[model samples]
Target: MPGRRTTTVEFVRGSVRGGRRRARSWLPSMFTLANMMCGFFAILVAFRGEYRLACALIALSVVFDIADGAVARLVGAVSPFGLQFDSLADLVSFGLAPSLLVFALFSDGRDSLDALGWIACFLWVACAAIRLARFNTTIDPTADKRYFTGLPSPGAAGVVLASVFAFADLMEGRDRLWMLLVVLVPGLLMVSNVRYRSFRSLVSPKSGKPYGLVVTVVVVLVGLATVPTVTCCVVAYSYLVSPLVVPVLTPLGRLVPDRLKEVLS
Candidate 1:
């Protein structure tokens, strides 16, 4: 009787452990769902003519998208399920939502440029899909996660969002040609091989350099606060042009030590 009781207790404990593991696996998916929900809401709000608020929701979706991965890693919940789910959420949040924002922004133009704007937005969605598919199929476990092979969906969406926010009022009366360029350039870059800094290595918790991390984050936040439009534009455009600058600065880069160059880059 005593042996049977002990056996039953052990069985219950094992069952509970299994339950906890399953729960952890679903945790990241919840964040992914949150991301999708934000994107969906952004679309709804955009339909109601709340463009600024809709863009803000898309930005919020970006936060949820980031948190899902971070939580998955922290909880040892990384799985193929989480990866696929994240990609799908990204499609809606980064791909569809931004395209909707673009359409909403230019829908009233009623000109050839507006038609061009719509085409550009459609191209962005296609590129985003291609980018995600390529990323999933070619994910190299040993590859440098410090730099993405091309512009990420979130970053591309961010450029759109920041542009909308910065020039929401001015965009109406301005030449829509530049608007076409804004929508098209980031889309093209998504499908290109331009390397963008990932900033993942900078915030690695295992780095044992929290002071530097905190300082870097504070500096960025301060910059964002001061002249946000210029700061956002500079940051986004810098990533776009960084690859070009690398070759031009090769001579100066040669003067820096290899280790320092790696860190700076």
Candidate 2:
């Protein structure tokens, strides 16, 4: 009887351990799902004419997207499954959601002008898809982790979200010719050869200075709360132009090999 009790206890312990391992494996996927839900709901809200709320939801999706990657790294659960899932979620959140938001903002869907708006939005979606595919295919473990080959989809989305949120009233009143520039420029940058820095490198598990990063993030969050529109616009546009400015304003360009420089520029 005592022996039977011991065996049962061991079995229970083993079951608990297995359950925990399964939960850990699913953690990143859970976050990715949250990202997808935010994007999906954002699209729904955009169709409902809640543009501000839709923009906010797309912005919230960014937090989930970042968290999923960070959690995967923290738990050492990085897998090809996770990578593919993340990309699909990003397509919804960063690619489709933003494009839909922009279309909803600028189009009434019945005129020649609206037709032009639809084209611009479609171009943005295509660029985002191409950008994400290139990133997945061209990932190099030995390459400089500090930089991305093109503007990230999330960054491109942020540019659109920020601009729309900041100038919502003005854009509603004015001719939306400017919307073409906003959509097209970021779309082009996504597929461009320009190299932009990855903030991930700064707060990576390997980085010894995560505390400084945490403090900086807290400060930025506070700024976001106080002046959400201005802060978002500044951060989004600064990231967009950083690649061009970094090379000219700093000596980093000189460090690039001749072959790499051609591609980066």
Candidate 3:
């Protein structure tokens, strides 16, 4: 220790990192940044033909996204600025970015949907803006977590990304009409009023009995890692169908408990 020497560069680097830690205490900001970063990388990944990785990053961003709000509350750092930043990042990550990735991957530059398809991308951004705006305006004292008034925009983006990846190789030589159906359907779904499960609620409610849930989540993570492409397709498709399943079967209706009604109402 007596012979130890200190350098200005190391001290400066430490100071900068310390500053970042304090700044990152605002949790939602960190999550929002991650979402933007994911979208940024997604564009590059698609261009590089590493589509599976791109989709995975987008999915990972969704997880980070769900955490941002919760983290904001936990850290007592809720702010209008963070909220706006989240919306902007989401529009990039889940709205415009996914849309561009789809066209880039699946389209002929000369098709009619070339014009129409680009416009459809805006539906995602517009609907997401509306959804977030509605959420901010409609706050209730009740702790209700059941259904979404409409399909969540980010979930819709996930389905779109999943579809592209699921049938990545299979898409070649598929009927043009079929591709059209795939592109348009998910765009419509983003703006539809269908109930979707919100895992965000479980965070607080299950905070008490954390161990069992933690183990279960760990297992699920293992399953996801084992087969990324196939697993995402299955999960996203299952979610896309749940809205239809929810309406047709009373049993499906039962899946969304009464508390969820507050949300839809």
Q: Of the candidates numbered 1 and 2, which has the greater TM-score value?
A: 1
* Cα lDDT of model 1 by residue, 1-265, tens digit: 9999999999999999999999999999999999999999998888777888987898889889888888899899999888888999999999999888778778766665666767888898999999999999999989888889888888888888878777766766455456667778888998898887774554564555466567667877898888777777776676667778877887886787877644544
Predicted candidate 2 versus true structure: per-residue lDDT over 182-229, tens digit per residue: 899999999998888885774563654355567667877998999988
In candidate 3, what are the lDDT values of residues 1-265, reduced to their tens digit?
Answer: 4334456667888999888766766657988899889988987887676777777788877888888978887776778788788878887788766766776665543565565556655565676667666655665658356566566767777887787777765655334335445556666665566567665653455445465456656766776789767777776777778767756786676678676543433
> Any residue pairs clashing in model 2, and if so which?
none
What lDDT does the true structure give each of the candidates? 0.82, 0.86, 0.69
Worst 10 residues of 1 by lDDT: 200-209
**Candidate 3: where are CA atoms >4 Å away?**
1-25, 108-113, 141-143, 173-179, 202-204, 210-219, 246-265
> Candidate 2 at residue 66, lDDT?
85
Which regions of candidate 2 fall more than 4 Å away from where they truly are?
1-8, 172-174, 205-207, 210-215, 251-265
The TM-score, computed over Cα atoms with residue i paired to residue i, of candidate 2 is 0.86
Per-model TM-score, in order, reads 0.87, 0.86, 0.73
Clashing pairs in 1: none
